[model samples]
Target: MAKLTVERLKKQFGTSIAVDELTLEVAQGEMVALLGPSGCGKTTTLRMIAGFVAPTSGRMLLGGNDITRVPPHVRETGLVFQSYALFPHMTVAENVGFGLEMRGVSRAQRGPLIAEALGLVRLSHLADRFPKQMSGGQQQRVALARALAISPKLFLLDEPLSNLDAKLRAEVRTEIRSLQQRLGLTTLIVTHDREEALTMADRLVVMEGGRVRQVGSARELYEEPRDAFVAEFVGRCNLLPATREDDERVRTRGGLLLSSRRRADESSSASTLAIRPERIAIEPGHHAEIKGQLEAVTYLGAHTEYQVLLGESERVVVTRPTPVRDDPMLSVRTNDPVSLTWDTEAPRLIPETAKD
Candidate 1:
């Protein structure tokens, strides 16, 4: 395993800037996930590290050796693409051993390495089966085994689970996490799925518009987003427009008072309130209450989602988990008078300058 580092890596295509002065590090045996929407430069950054795309400027180093200009084959990194590029004509064993073959490993010595790689992905029994004979999950595991057989210093995956179904995605998610931990591989994954990145990565690197937005553990980003983009992107959040009163007070522009969850910086001009849907209570409580009409209700089995039209101008959404005893919100319907409230410290004060 090796520590990977990139310093001010940049990539530009004509008038379009794909990545802008990106800098980050992955310690030995650490897994970091890069998350963002399409065209956010996540994939371009990964390709730069893999040596498939040369950086327009800046440097990349693996274990202190500069490999910014190194060719892909000489970089010694294993890559698993979104599409598992296994040869349909080759058997599983042949597919996994292709990397070794290209590196000129003796034919006699490749058997044990192939078997070990297959065993790691729990596909040793299907080694002789062709790609046409295996399931999608099995095929993906074979691709992973192929990458592992080369004993790469850094393991890079680009949306490794996007092709799998929901159930298969969950199963493979657990499998990939466990496999990475067992091998202690220094890995970097590029994904647009927040939940996937949160569950798999030790730390998250969120990006947008060719720049880094925030870097933190999953819980930190979820609980205390530094900006409005992060607040709404990491999870389901409502950014209510608010007017500031002195330094400690704020209310919705529509005149609903809300307590700030976090203390704002003395220099900050907080003009918005950020709150998660699940944090709001369905009924009146000791906290600040606001009246609205329940415009829509969606029964999502474990939780019910309500779109409340506050007065005639604002809308606040609430997601409440189904209770074992009873939830009065269940009988509530559209246009009904709904009283919603939240604890004194549930909403966050977002400064106007921090929103992106």
Candidate 2:
């Protein structure tokens, strides 16, 4: 395991800046995920760390050793690309032992280690099978075994599960996480899938426009997003225009007063109120501070999503666990007058400057 550090990293291609002044630290044996949408510089950052793309500026350190100028082969970093980059003609054992061969390990010295690597991924029985004969998941495991056989200081995966089908992806994801935990490897995974990042990472680094937006654990980011971008990117969020009051309260556009931690700062010129759909409660009576007519209802498996049009200017979406079929209070119809209420602690205030 190794502690990886990147300081003020930058990369550019002609007039386009791919990565900009990004800096982060991954502690030894920690699993850190770089998460963002396409073109957010996640892959670029990964490549820089693997030494496939040299940074235009900044430095990289591994285990407190300066490795900014080292070549990819010398960096001792193992990379598993999105496509299973296995040799088509080589059998499982051959592929797993290829790294050892390149490093000049004798054939006798590589056999048991190769077998152990295949067994670690549960591919020991198919050691003689070629890549074409194996399933996608099996081939992926072979790739993983190949990377592990090299005993790298840092393990870097670039969307390794993207190519698998949905079901296989889920299964293989759990297997990979379990293996990483058991081995206690310091790993960095770059992925566009938000759920994958949220579930697998010990800490997440969210990026946008070639810069780091926020870095926190899943619970911290989900419960308290620093800005609109982080809130909306990590999960579903309802953003409503709001103004700060003299008493440190936030007033929504529908004239609903919501308690907030503090007023928006001067940089927060376009402040808005953000709330999760699950936080809103749907009731029949008129006790709600905000009322709206139901516009649409979507029946999800565990929950029902309701879209409510508040007055004429604002729309709020709320989701609640589906009620029993016999429950009369929740069998709501379109255009029905409904009351929506939420806990004062639920609404989060966003400064105008923080609005994305």
Candidate 3:
């Protein structure tokens, strides 16, 4: 396993930029995910690292060696495509040994490598099956095995589970994470699914508008988002337009004062206060720090979500574990007035002009 480093990487298409000065490092044997919505440059960055796309500027290093100009096949990086990219004419074993063949490995030496790779993904029994004969999950595993067979220094997965059904995605993601950890593979995954990144990665890089917004562990990004974008992207958050009134106080646009953990920056013109839905507690009566009318209640098996209307237009959402049948909240109806409260540290102040 080796560390991967990208420094001030930039890419431009004609006049539009696809990736802008992106810098990140993946530690040896650590799994990191590039997480963001479409066209946010996550895919472009991955392609650049894989050598499929050339960077407009900057450099990349793998294991302390400069690989900025290396060709894709010679880079010694194993990449699994989003589409699986398996050839229909080949069986699983043939697919797994293709990279080795291209690298001039003799057929006599390829059998054990192919078998080991298939075994790692629990697909050794399907070595003779063609791509068309397998399910999506199986095909994805074959693609993974094909990548793994090379035993490259860096492993890359581009939306590896996107093509699978929801249940299959869940199962396969768990399998892939387990395999990556067991092998101590230095891996990087690109995905738009927040849950996938949060659950599978040691750290996450959130991107927007072809630039990185924040990069940290799941807990850090969820609990201490640097701005409104990171706060809302990593999880569900209620972001209120706020103005600094004091070091630890801010007045919302709706005229509600809220306590925050972050001290107000004197030079900033505005701040956005972020509160996670799960952190806010809903009270039965209108007697807490803020009062609101219940607009809706949604029961989601293990948890329930409540949408509350504060003032005339501000809306806040609260999430809690589903209550028992006899719980008082079960009796509350839409339009019922309710109060909301949270610990003083629950709200995070986001500067209007925060940078990555």
Candidate 4:
């Protein structure tokens, strides 16, 4: 296992800056994810670490050794791409052993190691099958085994499961996490899938437009995002513009006064308040509730999402448990009168200018 450190890492393409002085660290035996949308420079950062894309300016270190100039072949890092990248004509055992063979491992030493690697991914039984004869999930496992066969110091996965179907993706993610934990390998994964990053990473680094937005655990980013962009991007939220008052409170444009722990004295006369849909409650005929008309209802398997229009300009989203009957009491339809309420402590206040 190795600790990976990136210092002021940067990459540029012509006039556009891909990665802008990004710095982060991955502790030994820890799993860290570089998460963001396309063209956010996450994949470019991964490529830099793998020596696939040379950084315009930066330094990469592994276990206190400066390897910024190391070539890909001598980096001792394992990489798995989204497209399995396995040789179609090569058998599973042969594919797994290819890396070992390239390093000139004798046949006697390569065979057992290949078998062990396949067994680690639970593909020992299919060792003789070619890549063409295997399912997408199976092919991915072979690719993983090939990476592990060489016993690399670090493991890098660039959207490794993006090609698999939903069910297979989930299953394979679990397997990969389990395998990494057992091997105690330090791993870095780059992905745009929010749930996958939240589920698999010990810590998440959210990037935007070539800069680091926020770096924290899944729950931290979900509950206490630093700004409106991070809040909206990491999860579902309802943004309501409001004004900062003297008593540590914010009054929304719709005449709703919300109490919060944040003092908005430094903020301008206008600010934005964010709340998660799950935090909002649909109370029936409550006088203290903010009045709204149900605009739409979406029945998700575990919960029902309601788009509530408050007053003339304010809108809030609320999610509640799905009803039991076809038409339950909470089965509010479009244009139906409803009240939206939530705990004041749940609201996150952001300066209007901080909003993206």
Best by TM-score: 3
In candidate 2, what residue range of length 10 has the lowest lDDT sum?
261-270
Per-residue alpha-carbon lDDT of model 4 for 20-66, expressed as tens digits?
A: 99999999989999999999999999999999999999899998899
Error of 3 at 172 (Å): 0.9
Candidates ranked, most accurate by TM-score first: 3, 2, 1, 4
Which scores better on lDDT, 1 or 3?
3
Model 4 stretches astray by more than 4 angstroms: 253-256, 263-270, 325-331, 351-356
Where does candidate 4 have its weakest 10-residue lDDT segment?
Answer: 261-270
Report the Cα lDDT for residue 325, model 2: 69
TM-score per candidate, in order? 0.93, 0.94, 0.96, 0.93
lDDT winner: 3
- Candidate 2 differs from the real structure by a C-alpha RMSD in angstroms, to one decimal, of 2.2
Expressed as tens digits, the lDDT of each residue in 1-356 for candidate 2 is 79999999999988889899999999988999999999999999999999999899999999999989999988988888888889998998999999899899999999999998898899999999999998889989999999999888898999989999999989888988998899988999999998899988899999988899889999878877777788888999998888877444777887766665563442346477888999998876456767788889899989989898887768888998888867754667888888987776787876533533
Encode model 1's per-residue lDDT on 277-302: one tens digit a residue: 99988763223357777788888898
As for candidate 2, its clashing pairs are: 268-352, 268-353, 269-352, 270-352, 271-352
